[model samples]
Target chain A: MLEIINLHARVGDKQILNGISLQVRVGEVHAIMGPNGSGKSTLAQVLAGHPAYEVTAGQATFQGRDLLDLEPEERARAGLFLAFQYPVEIPGVSNAYFLRAALNEIRKARGQEELDPIDFMDLAEEKLKLVEWGPDILSRAVNAGFSGGEKKRNEILQMAVLEPTLAILDETDSGLDIDALRIVAEGVNRLRRPDNATVVVTHYQRLLNYIVPDFVHVIAAGRIVRSGGRELALELEAKGYEWLTEAVPA
Target chain B: MSRAILQDYQALHPQGAPQAGWLGRLRQRGLDRFQETGYPTSRDEDWRFVDLAPLTGAEFRVGGDSPAVRPEALAPYRYPGTECMLLVFVNGQFVPGLSDLGSVPAGVTVGSLASITARQTELLGHHLGRYAPIESSGFTALNTALIADGLLLHVARDVQVPRPIHALFVTAGDPAGLATHPRNLVVLEPGARASVIESYAGLSEGAYFTNAVTEAIVGDGAVLEYLKIQRESERAFHVGTTHMRHGRDSRGTSHSVSFGAALCRNNLDVVLDGPGVEAQMLGLYMGRDRQEVDNHTSLLHAHPNCSTREVYKGILDGRAHGVFNGKIYVTPIAQKTDAKQTNRALLLSDHARIDTKPQLEIFADDVKCTHGATVGALDQQASFYLKSRGVAGPLARKILTYAFAAEVLDEIPFPAVRESLEAVVMARLNARGE
Candidate 1:
């Protein structure tokens, strides 16, 4: 569902993601394990069309459409969703109202009738259950004063409601506990199906134990230095990334 | 109009007038003060940032006895729900035929200042311009001199009026070189609580000037919630001043919203004289095209143990300019006073500008006062966040601006006002092609 060829991206004047290429097919979960400053987050930001990340040289295609040319919102409407590593805190806007507005935007783009408040509430309730979230989070300001675990779970809840074809989970397990991590991974697993895909980016192989991936790639110096099977994540966790970077010919 | 105004000032301020009764003496004294002060200039400290060039050069006559606008023409100014009392003014003249006070509670008195000149004359005598300074304020004095009639409302002691009183002011006839003045007096007796909504709207397509003043007195332990909304034609010029004095233990809240005009300036001042008095001053403005709006607010803590809060926000589009100056004063006797203020603006265009100033004068060392100001475009990061959620660019801007204003609007406790204000804000935004 997604393809990248020699992606070169930068945050301001400093280039973060060098030439990187990867592909994820339908019904497959691609796990990218990298250490800090490995450009794993940069890849997700570039894919999400973050304005701060300029794609200087890259050819990214999603569902047969060129992705780099579209604006962030256009890319989102074209079936792309990024679960932010750190969710933004939007004060003065109720979580429920903001989420509904987002859902309606996506629905409207699909030539579908927008969901009224009643229907929206029903859908929101069902989706909240995916992450074991409750109605209490609905009235609170968007992610304001939210606990780390609650923020992670809220990201999953938004994904379930948006139902993007290509979902990129950017360090969703970073600040989550074991229980919260499992709930988030399970939510992703439930949404998985043929003709759709998920990409899980994490620093550790812990979250991999919950949401199994068909392929694993270790990113270093902005490129995927190694590609292996699902067991490769465990092998890297055991050996660490020092040898991987050393193995890359200097 | 200038000649007539100068003539009246001369008549009101002849020498030896102070030797007469206190009222006559005061008027004569005020006349002399007016002669000495004449009119405020931008060079003055208080008017340093205010540009009165448009009003200075313009020649305008006092609004005369022209027939009121048709009822259908005033339909847009009406509000829904039960109105305890309604007052309508056309060209500064009271319109009793257009007013309705059937919903007022028993023992509450609501009448036109022109009609009940006898019974309310004494009450008006004691508190006319004494609560404010008309000598230095050209618009305030002009309104006082030419004001044909206005509103006088008194709520009995301890009575809580469940419904709000609506006051609508409209100007008729082409305003080629004419102006109107309307004065409103509102007094909430001891322990009485009420809400008043005053709207200044225009029906004429001409450039009329509306110079109005509203003075309010909150009796001991009384609570007053007042909202002033201004929606004038593009060619109109509006200058308004509101003076409020809170009695001991009384509470006052004023929310002012303006949609700009050719030239609009508002001076809202409050004096907290009684202990435990609390006051809240809030303002918001949304302007498009070449409209300009300037708002100045002052709060005085005269006695001990008082609290005050102020928040003002503005959204400027095209070449619109916005100005905000808020002053908070704490006297030596006003120990334990707590004051806070914030002014923020969103400039939608490169040329749009905002001048915000917060002045605090504290003679009491035991008081706590903090103020903040900011001017910026929409948050680029927040806009991107919403865009990534599938919302379009224009919709994203609307959401951000709405959230910015919601900081003040959300804290309102009344649901009806909250909903109505939301609708009004949304409609105003949509009118700007949002």
Candidate 2:
């Protein structure tokens, strides 16, 4: 469903992602693990077409289309989703209003009819249960005064509503407690299907415990150094990333 | 240049027939003050950022014959779903044929200030020019000098007005330098409650001047909700001042929304004269295409245990300019005062500019006061966050800008007025292309 070949990206003078390559097929869950500054988040952001990062060299394709050439919204409309590590706070836009606008835009792009406010509210109420939240959050501003856990759940709620073909979660479990982490994991797990794929970018192994990945890849210095199955994450949890870095040649 | 324009105005309209009465003396005093001050120059502190050349260079004729206005032309300015007392004014003259008194409540007086009789003279004389002193502002002085006809609403003690009072001031005429000065007086007795909406709109895209002053007196334990809507012609100049005085335990709120006019200045002043007074001031101004809008507000806490809240937001695009100056003062006798002021502006173009200042003077040591101001372009992170949700770039920007404005528009209590203004604001924002 997604492919990246020798992707080299930079923000300003700093080259963050150097020669990183990965591929994922339909219905497969891929987990990218790395230590701090190893470019794990950068890769996810690059795939989402963040304006701050420029693709210096390499190619990224999603569903056989060149992802680097598309704008961020175009990428989103084309079924590419990135759950941000730090969700932005929009002071005046209600969460429901924003989500509906997004869903309508995506629906229009796919040649489908847009849902009206009443119909959208029905769908939103149904989706709220997946994240174990009530309807009060929908009326409030988007992440304006939300707690850390609420913001992460809101991201999951958005993911469930948009239903992207390929989703990338960048450190969605950082600020969540155990209960929030379980709720978020359960929400993502429930949305898993045969035709869609998810790439989980996490630094810890606790999140993988709830939503197990089929493939685990450890990245060092912007390059994936080790590739294995679910056991690889357990091994990394037992032994720090320094062991892997020392084992791999510079 | 200002002196020349003033001389021209004085030549055309002489301060006529100073007779033996308090009204005559008031008019004469206003004329004398206006002549002495002429017009504030750029050197004045309060008028530093505003250039008066456009207003002073134009020779405006005062008190012309009322221009013909089609009833259909007034439809866009009227609140359709809202039922209230309606008073219409054209070129500073009351149009009784076009107004509806609409079943006024008992002991509530709703009519034109020009129609006052001997029975209401005692009440009118006490509060006419009490709150808004004309010595400081030449525009206020001029409005007082030429006070002909405007709105007059009075609620007796312990009376609760069943409906809002809407005073619609429409300016329609030839583009030949016509000017109108409207004076509005609202007095609410103790334990009374009322809402007043003052709207100023222009039907003709002409060069005219609208100098208006509204003075409100809220008695002890009274409640007042005042709203001012200004949507003048794109080529018109508007200067308005609203002064309010709150008695003990009184509550008042003022919402000022400005959308049109080439150059507009709004001054809102409030004084908390008694303990337990609460006042809120909310304002929103949207300017585009070289339009200039300035809002100046002053809140004074003269007694103990009073609270005030003020928030003003501005949106400027193209080469439009905006200015916001807010001041909060807590006197020594005003202990336990709580005051908060916030001013925010969004500049949507490279040439759009905003000058915001917040001043606070607190003499009471045991008071809580906070003031903040921010001016910037659209937030980059917020824009990206919206776009990343599959919204197109232009639509994302528009939504964010609209949301920035909705923060203030949503504060309107009346649904009909709020919805109509919301529609107008949305249409205006959408008309500015991507």
Candidate 3:
């Protein structure tokens, strides 16, 4: 469902992601684990078409469309979603309003009928339960005063409603508590389908335990150094990133 | 002011030579002050940032009795769903013949300054020329000399007007082929409450000048929610001043929104005379093309246990320029005063400009006073976030900028007014493109 071929990207004058390649087939969940300086988050941001990150070389295709050529919003309408690691706190804009705008845009792009406020609220309520959050949070500004856990859950709520064909969850579990991690994982797990793919970017192996991945790739420096099945996550968890970096030649 | 135009215009109205007595004395004193003060040069501190050159060069049209005001002519804004009294004025003179006073509460006298100038001279004397009529500025002298009693509003003590009073001043193409002045005095007696909607509306496409002044006295414990909407014709020029004095425990909220006129200048001067007073001034301005809007606000906290908060936001597009100077003054006796102010500007076009200064002049050492000013474009990241969610670029920026201005609008107490203001802002944003 999603493919990256020799993807190399940079942010301004500094190159961040260098020669990284990965593929996720339908119905499969992939976890990319790496150290602090690793290009794991950069890959997610580049794929989402973040303006800061420049794609020096390589291409990413989602659903047979060249995703790199599309703007961030265009990529989103084409079924590519990026659950931000640190969701921007937009004061004065309510969560429900933001979500409705997003939903209407995507619907319009796909030539589907738009949903009114009443129907949009109904859909949002259903997805709110999937992430274990109530309507109170949406009533306030978008992530204005939300807690770390609430922000993470809000991201999942967006993912569930959009139901993207391919979702890139970057550091979703970093600041989340165990319960929030479980709720976010449950939301992602529920969206799993035979024709959709999910990429979970994390530093620790704990997130993978809750939302088990079919494959795990260890990233170091600017490239993916190792690739293995789900067990590889457990191995990295026991042995810290010290051994993982040593295994990669300078 | 050049040596050529330095000649006093007030010479037309000589010193009590042939006039109507003591009120004649005010006109004479005002004229003398105008001659002595001359035209306010930019050298004056108050007129420092504002350049009166354009206002001076723009054909200085004077008043003359020619074409009569027609009521049916004010078809542009027939504001419906309003139970309040409506006062309409053309140029500077109040047209009682064109107004609809309907059923005003007793003791509440609302009329044009011309009416007071002729009939109720005693009432006009008590407050007229109370403040410095002629500022040290050049334009101030010009307005003093040209003004024909803008409008008069007097609410007796404890008179609670249940409905709003809409004062519509329309600047039309010259009756005498000249400019106009709309000066007003609004005095809310002790314990009185009222809502005033002062609109600077346009009538013609002529390059007319609408120099206006509104002096309001918010008496003891009185609450005034004033909204000034400046939607003048792009061909007209506007220079306005709103001088307000708050009594003990009084509350005043002023929302000034200007979106029209070739060059618009607003001097919102408020002084908290009594203790336990609260004053909040909020405004939003949008400018485009060569249009210029300068908002000069000063809150003088002279008493103790007072609070004042101000927020002014400006959105500049094209090559338009916006100037915002928000100053808060805390005197020595004004202890335990809580004053906070913020001036923000969002420049959409690279060629647009904004000069903002959040001035805090504090003499009370124990008071809590804070001021901040920020000038920048929309948050690119937040716009990207919205765009990434499939919202168009222009719409995303509009949403963000609207959200920014909403912070100031949220301070308004009236929900209906808030809704209308929001709609007006949204419409303005929608009409422009990136």
Candidate 4:
């Protein structure tokens, strides 16, 4: 479903992701774990067509389409979603309105009929229960004055609404409490279908307990140093990233 | 040519005309002041950024016979709902057949200024020119000198108006170089409460000028909300001045929305005359093409314990120019006054420009006042965030711009008004193309 070959990227003068390669099939969950500034989040952002991260080298393909050649919006329309680590606070835009716009945009791109506000609300009401949030949050400004946990839940809510074919959750578990983490994970877990894929990028293995991944890759200094089964996350959690850093070739 | 225009206006009435009396004296004073001030040049501090050459160069004749307009033609501009008394005017003259007062409650008088009878003369005389200081600006003085028609609203003490008053000014004609001065006076007695909406629109595409002034007095403990929306013909020019005076413990609010006219300038001055007063001023101006919109607002905290908040936002596209000058003055006796002012502008094109000046004059050390101004394009990150969710680039820009303008539009207390304004804003954005 997704493939990245030597994905070398940079922001301004400094390079971040260098010669990173990854592959994932349908119905498979991949977890990319790394220390701080190991290009874990950078990979997620670059795959989503973030303009700040220049793709200096390499090619990426998603569902047989050139993912690196698409714009951010084009990537989204192509069923690629990126749950931002820090969801932006867009004051004056109601959450319900934002969600409806995003959903309708995706629907229209796929040659499907757009849902009216009333129908969209009905659809959103069901998704609201997935995040254990009431309808009041829909009327409030998007992530304005929201707690850290609420922002994470909002991101998960977007994931549920858009229903992308491939989603990259970049450190979504960083700011969430244990309960919020469980709710977000459960929401992601329920949306997993045989044709769609998800990439969970994080620093810790606690999230894997909820939505267990099929593959865990340890990334250091912009390169995936090790690839193993899900047990690799537990080993890294117990030993810390220092052991992985030392094991990587200089 | 300049002298001929004012000379022709002054020639409309004879000197010491018996019908004029005190109004004649007031008009004479206004005319003298206007002649002395003339049209302000860019060298003047207040008029530095706004160029009035297009407005001043045109030879706009004084009021002529207003063209007849059907009541149904104004249905679009009318606010939805039942709690409003509609007063329609064409060419600055009240259209009685189109107006619907529907038996206003006792102590509440809503009528045309030209129709103020002998019994209501004292009421109009007391509050007409008191709040609007004519010596401050040439436009106000000109409006005062030539003002002969507009809306007159007066509410007695302790009387809460059950319905809002809607004053609609529609200019319908292709009359070349036509001009009209509309004057409005609203007086809410002690403890009285009411909301008033003023709309300025044009029925035809013509080169005309509308110079309007509205003076409002909110008595002690009273509450007044005034909304002025300008949607004139693209070829027309509009200049409006609104003055509000708040008495002890009174509250006042004004929302100014400008979206039309070749040249538009609005002056809003609010004076907190007594303690415990609250004043709020919110404005949104979306200018495109060659349109130029300027808003100058001043808040005077004359008494202690007064609070004032102001937020003005502008969206400029194409070669449009937007100007905002917000001034807050806290006097020595205005201790403990709290004042905050913010002006933000979004420039969608390289040629688009915005000149913002925030002035704060504090004479009292105990007051808390802050002012800020910013000019920039839409946040690329925020835009990308929306676009990343499947929203296209153009839609993303529209959404972000809409959010910026909503900061002021959301402050409008009336949902119906806010919704209609939102539609207008969206249409304006869409008209700019993808």
Candidate 5:
């Protein structure tokens, strides 16, 4: 479902991600773990088409489309979703309204009929329960005054509502409490399908226990130094990235 | 040419030096003040950010007549889904045929200022020109000097009008380049409550001027909600001033929304004369093209235990200019006063400009006063968040801009007005193509 070949990116004159390659087939869940400033988040952001991150040299394909060539909105319409590590707080815009706009835009792009307000609310109600949130949060401003846990849950709620073909969750487990982590993982676990894929990027092995991944890759100094089965996550959690840093190419 | 027009306007009035009553003296004093000050230049401290050349260079005659316009022509501007006591003024003259005063309650008077009877004149003599003195500003002086037709609202003591009173001033192009000064007087007796909406619009494409002044007196324990919607023609000019006085334990709210006119300026002043009063001033201005919108607000805390809050926002695009000057004065006797003033501007284009100045004159020791202003472009993070959700770039910009303006727009208590203004703002944003 997703492929990346020798991806290189930069911010301003400083290089961030250098020569990183990865592939994920349908029905597979992959976890990319790294230390602080190890270019793990940069890889996810570059794939999502954030304008601030310049792609120096890279080629990425999602569902047989050139993901790197599309705009951020166009990439979204092509079934590529990026759950931001820090969701922006937008005042005066209700969560329900923002979600409805997104849902309708995607629907229109796929040549489907748009839902009215009543129908949209009905659809949102089902997704709200999946994330263990009430409908009251939807009427409030988008992420305004929401707790860290609620914000993380709201991102997962959006993911459930949009039902993207591929979702890249960057640092989704950073701010969640144990209960919030379990709920978020449950939501993501419930949405899994044979034709969809998810790429979980994190620093710790805590989230891997909830939504177990099929593959775990340890990234250090902008390169994936090791790739192994899910047991590698448990090994890294016990040993930390100290051993992985020495294994990088000098 | 401008001086000649001013002289001709004075001569067109009744051929008398001055009458014997206070109203007559007010008119004469207004003329004297206007003659001495003329139009304010940018050199003045209050007018530093505004250039009056475009308004002063044009010659606009005093208007007292209006051409015939169908009633259906005003349907688009009417407040939808609300049955308001509508007062229509065409070229500064009240049109009885277009006005509907059937909903006015007993002991409440809502009609044209020109039709104020001798009996009602005595009731308004104390509050008419007291709050909005002509000597305060040049435009107020000019409006008072040439005041022709406006609304006269008098709510009896302890009476609350259930329906809002709508005052619509339409500048018809009967005589092109016409100017009209409409002076409104609103007197709420002790414990009285009312909601009033003042709207200014143009009936034709000619470049006209509407100089309006509204003086309101909120009696003890009275509550007043006032809204001003300025939607003039693209080629027209507008200058409006609203002066209000609040009594003990009274509450007053003013919402000023500007979206039209080549050049528009509004001055809103509120005085908490008695103790335990609350005043809130909210404003929103959206400008495009060469349009310029300026708003000046002042909240005077004269007594103790009073509070005032102000929020004024501006969105400028396409080289438009915006100015916001907010001042809060806490007198020595105004102890335990709470005041906050915030002015924010969102510049959509590099050439768009905004000038904001917040002045705080606090003489009281036991008071809390805060003021802040921010000017910046759209938040890139917010934009990217929306765009990544599949919303187009243009739509994302529009949504963010609308949200920026919604903070002030939400302060409006009328739903119909809010919806209409929201639509107007959306339409303006859509006009700027992707």
Candidate 6:
């Protein structure tokens, strides 16, 4: 479903992602684990086409389309989603209104019929149950004064509503408590389908226990040095990343 | 140039009627004041940022008969869905044929100010020219000097007006150097409640001037909701002043929205004279092209236990310029006074500019007064967040800009008016073609 080959990206003068490559097939969940400053988040942002980061050299293809050539919104319309670590606060714009606008735009791009306000509200209400949230969040401003857990859950709710083919969860469990983490993981797991995939990026292995991944990859200095199954996450949690870094050649 | 404009006005109304009563004396006094201090120059402290050369250099003659206007031309300015009293003015003259004098309830009077001044001389004499002083502003003096016709609203004691009063002023005629001065007076007795909307619009896209003044007196325990909308021609110039006086325990709220005109200045002065008075001043101004919009507000807490809240926001694009100057004064005797003021501006282009100043004078030791100002561009993170959610770049910008403006519009109390104004603002923002 997604492919990256020797992705080289940088922010201004700092080279964050030196050389990275990864591939994910249909119905498979991939977890990219690394320590701090290991370009885990940068990979997700670069894939989402964040304007601050420039791809020095590399190729990223999603469903056989060059992802780097499309704009952020076009990439989104092409079934690419990135759940941000720090959600933005857009004051005076209700969540329902924002989501409806986004959905309509995406629908138009796909040559589908746009939903009216009444129909959109009905669909939103059904999706709200997946995140265990009530209808009040729909009327509030977009993440204006939301709690840390609420923002993360709101991101998941958007992902569910948009129904992207490939979703990149970038530190979605950073500030969440145990209960919130479980609920978020449950929400993500429920939305998974046979034709879709999820790439979870994390610094710790606690979130993986809830949403178990089929493949685990350890990235050190912007290069994937280790690849294994679900058991590799538990082994690294018990030993630590220092052992893996020491074993890899400089 | 200043003398020529004043001379043209004098030539139109050659002082033939014998000056007899207080009304005549008031007009004479206003004329004298205006003659003494002509149009304010850039050297004046309050007029530093705004230059009046465009207004003074033009030879705009006053007191001209307006051409006939079709009903369709007036539809855009009227609140069609809302049930309200309608009064239409063309070229500063009341047009009864075009006005809809709806059946007002008992103890309420809504009619032309000039026609009813003779019958209610005592009431008009006491309230007219009371709140807006003529000595400070030349535009106010000029308006007072040429106050012929406007809206006159009076509600008796304990009367609650069933519907709002909408006064629509349409400047339709040859816009070549035509000017109009409209004076409005609204008085609500004790325990009375009312809402008034004053709108100024133009039909032709030419050079005309509208100098307007509205004075409202809110009696003890009365509540008043006043809204003023200025949507003049792109080449027109508008100078308007709204002065309000609140009695003991009275409440007043003013929503001033400016969307058009080449050069516009709106002054809102509110005085809380009695204890337990509550006043709120909300304003929004959107400017584009080379348009200039300036809002100057003054809140005076003259009594104890009075509270005042003010928020004024501006959205400027292209090479447009905006100015916000808000002053809050707490007198020495006014203890327990609470006042809060905020001014925010969003500039969409690098050439767009905004100058904001918050002035606070608190002589009372026990009072609480806070003021803040912010000027910035749209948040990049917020824009990117919207774009990532499938909204295009241009649409994302429009959404953010509309959201920034909706903050102040949401404070309006009238639903129909609020919805209509929201639509207008959104339409204008979308038309930016960003």
Best by TM-score: 4
Q: What is the TM-score of chain B in candidate 1?
A: 0.90
DockQ values, each candidate: 0.53, 0.46, 0.50, 0.60, 0.57, 0.53
Candidate 2 off by > 4 Å: A3-23, A30-47, A51-70, A84-161, A170-191, A200-250, B1-18, B68-71
- Residue-by-residue lDDT tens digits, candidate 6, B200-236: 9988888899999999999999999999999999899
The weakest ten consecutive residues by lDDT in model 3 chain A span A241-250
| Candidate 2 CAPRI-style tier | acceptable
Model 1 regions more than 4 Å off: A3-23, A30-43, A54-61, A64-69, A84-161, A169-190, A200-250, B6-36, B66-72, B81-84, B173-176, B303-305, B332-336, B411-421
Task: Kindly list the per-residue Cα lDDT of model 1 for residues B1-434, writing each as its tens digit.
Answer: 35766554445446665435444454455555555565577987777665777776777676557675778887666765344477888877778788777766775778787787677767778777777666648567656654456777788899988877878888777766667767788889999998888788877766778788899999999999998878887778888899999999999889898874687888998999799998899988877787888889989999988988899999888888888999898999899999999899999888888888888999999988999998998777778778878976677777788777766676555555555666667776667684
Alpha-carbon RMSD of each model: 5.3, 4.8, 5.5, 3.7, 4.5, 5.0
For all candidates, the clash counts are: 0, 0, 5, 0, 0, 0
* Candidate 6 structure quality by residue, lDDT tens digits, A1-250: 7999999999999988878999999899999999888889999999988999999998998999999999999999988899999999776678998999999998998999999999999999999999999999998878877999999999999998899999999999999999999989999999999999999999899999999999999998778879999999998999999988876555
What's the residue-level lDDT of A228 in candidate 2? 98
Q: Write the residue-wise lDDT of candidate 4 on B142-186 in tens digits.
A: 887876888899999999987889999998867458788899999
Candidate number with the higher DockQ (1 or 2)? 1
lDDT winner: 6
Clashing pairs in 2: none
- Give the C-alpha miss distance for residue B6 in model 4, angstroms: 6.1
Candidate 3 chain B, run of 10 with poorest lDDT: B1-10
Candidate 1, backbone clash total:
0
Each candidate structure's TM-score, on Cα atoms with residue i matched to residue i, is: 0.80, 0.82, 0.78, 0.87, 0.83, 0.81
Considering TM-score, where higher is better, how would the candidates rank from best to worst? 4, 5, 2, 6, 1, 3
Q: What share of the true interface contacts does candidate 6 keep?
A: 0.72
Evaluated against the true structure, the overall lDDT of model 6 is: 0.90
In order, the candidates keep a fraction of the true contacts of 0.70, 0.61, 0.70, 0.72, 0.76, 0.72
Q: Which lDDT tens digits does candidate 3 get at residues B144-248?
A: 555565657788899888888888887664532356666677889999998888888777776777777778889999989888888888766788788889999
